[model samples]
Target: MKAKLTDAFVKNITPPASGRLDIVDETTPGLVLRVMASGVKSWSIRYRPKGRKQLRESYGTYPSTSLSDARARAKALTAAASVGRDLVSEEAAAAAAKAEEEAKAKTIADVVADYIKAHVAKTRKAGVTEKLFANHIVPVLGKKTVGELRRADVVELLDSLKNKGWRTNAQVNRVHAALKACLNWAVEREYLDANPAAVVKKQVTERPRDRVLSDGELKAIWEATDVRTDPSRAFIRLLILTGARRDEIRCMTWSEIDLEKGIWTLPKARNKGHRDHVVPLSNEVKAILEALPRLGECVITTDGKIPYAGQKSLKESLDKAVGASNWEHWTLHDFRRTVTTGMSALGVREEHRERALNHAVGGIGNKVYDRHAYLDEKRAALQAWADRVMLIVDTSGPQNVVAFEAS
Candidate 1:
């Protein structure tokens, strides 16, 4: 009736004639091996709960469970039962808790998807922002849970970009900002306790850029555009003439322009300032627009439908032209600064200059209360800027003008 359960005994034991055979281990009390008529053996513990009938809990199958492990598990169950604790209920609660935690733990990639859908996708730069995260953040930390993400983890990710020279310091800062925004959104949604990036400092120190093009350099750049084609030539000229952001010009649609009115009205969606921006097109700028064939909805497009995406090639051609002049280093964005700097030198008032560049000025009162579009002032500034640029380009030495090779 009672004996020590061993591996050899389990393998040699005979199947019962009808139902099953129960053998209790005398060495370890209450541990039993039940051998069904089909010869299947399983380990279990039978215990009398306090003020309740006896109950059987199957620990595992015989051989697989092993005699020692079954006895250890049975002993623990017996101890719990003796203390009036219901082992079955306790185990079930623990199982449910583990399952709930697993269900609630969300990975970084999961949060990013939700964040993009709810927040980033609605923004104008959604495509760029999405690509930034995909290229920088997602590959390394996507699988890590938000709660487990620490400051060191974020530093590692940013440092990887820096170490690889994958991105510049300014670009690393942008990636950090995107991650911080996503984490903050998580906190606001109650999915996280805090943002790990909140304490992590930005990796790069950003300085105010003061690289303004001189009149000679501007003249060189203006003359260089003649070698380029329709969209590229017009695009570069507009950058100097209108003082608008590159994307604002590149993504310009036919609907946003009113050639008769000599205005380019950028809705809040296309504008970085997130407000309706009206740029007074100079006569020269209007001429470029008038000459552009309406192939599609957008203005600066080779195919007429899609926005121009040949910035890299365009920049190379521009560099070749600028390089010929032995001009100092400059970027396309420098043109905006060039226009702004040039306007200031030409005695354009601060407020109108800021407005011409579509920069938000003053406090909430000015932004919220000032309804004036300053159409006349803006028109005058553009006309003056265009006039000054034309004068500079005309004065460029014959050798300063070079043709940009066609793509």
Candidate 2:
């Protein structure tokens, strides 16, 4: 064993190597030092624990980790390990040592990119996930690396979302989901020891989806659609009647609709889930489509032109409709509920209801062949929903709940 000396005496002694090569300090067994050569000046504690083989722990690079501090840390760990602390405990001790500055080593931007490229892109539609990350996650956290990010950094970003309201919160929540997904990947890749974002919670500032519309609200939409000469009114009303996704509606073309067949075919590419779908249309929907001024290839046209471009076109018109009404806190999407709720009240079969809305549940293959040959029953249910919606719009009444014996 090397002779033990006080801290001052150990600090004074310089090894044979040049000034760059350092004698870090004494450890649990003996004096520890390093000889610098390449860009990395690594430290080694050449000592043995009690009843153990000799081994050296490479602490870190030099100048970056000062010789004095490195020696002091090595001595503490070696002392702990010598006292019979297990491997797991030693690892925990090592992690605690590295947590502070090293955690900050990864920037948000770098980790986000890696996580997207490595994991998220593979599972989700690359374009959709890319659009989401680019629009929301990267703007605030892009510059920072994985290690540098902390809980407060995430919290601060979340707090900024409060000003923009629910839609913004939707974006924020998605950003967090993307970040959590990416950071977990970092941990798996050994880029990080643990994911700091796993525990973060999304604050619920907005009310839960109570999307069922009210009596007066129904009346306003009805009056607007009924009296307005424009066919787009009927299209918006059908959106409420059908309960399909807005994108599904926006991209609808004439080829997809069969007036005689009484069905609308939504191609897989246009669906949010990227699956081919068919919507069971109501007579009210049929009447509306029949009345619309067809523009080009789309159904919702005025003078042979697609009304505006996408949902933005539809939303802009709806926004104008909303401005004309005496309303508070309602949107076009509430129609999906309008159909689902209206049907259940009118004794519609659950399977028929789900199918009518083109909701793909029970996986892709099951959805493909789960046809009931009950198109008449489904048409009746959809028509019932449309009737109820019209009744509410016509009379400004609430849900006309007509209970039936359970099937």
What clash count goes with each model? 1, 15
Tell me the tens digit of each residue's lDDT in model 2 across 53-118. 766666665557665776676667667667754443568788876774464575777666766777
Cα shift from native, residue 406, model 1 (Å) = 43
How big is the positional error of residue 316 in model 1, measured in Å on the Cα after superposition? 2.4
The lDDT of each candidate is 0.84, 0.66
Root-mean-square deviation of every model = 14.0, 13.2
Error of 1 at 17 (Å): 71
lDDT of 1 by residue, 1-407 (tens): 67777879887999898898889988777799999999899888988767777888888887788888988988888888888887887989999777556534888999899999999999999988999889889999999987688889999998888787752478888999999999999888766778988888989899877889888788777888888898999888888888888899899999999999888899998888998988888888988999999999989999987899988788888888778446665778989998888777777888888998989898998978889989998887778788788778775544222112221
Q: What is the lDDT of residue 32 in candidate 2?
A: 55
Q: List residue ranges in candidate 2 displaced over 4 A.
A: 1-132, 163-171, 185-193, 205-207, 225-235, 268-276, 291-328, 359-373, 392-407
Worst 10 residues of 1 by lDDT: 398-407
Which residue pairs in candidate 1 have backbone atoms (N, alpha carbon, C) closer than 3 angstroms, thus clashing?
Answer: 296-304
Which candidate wins on lDDT? 1
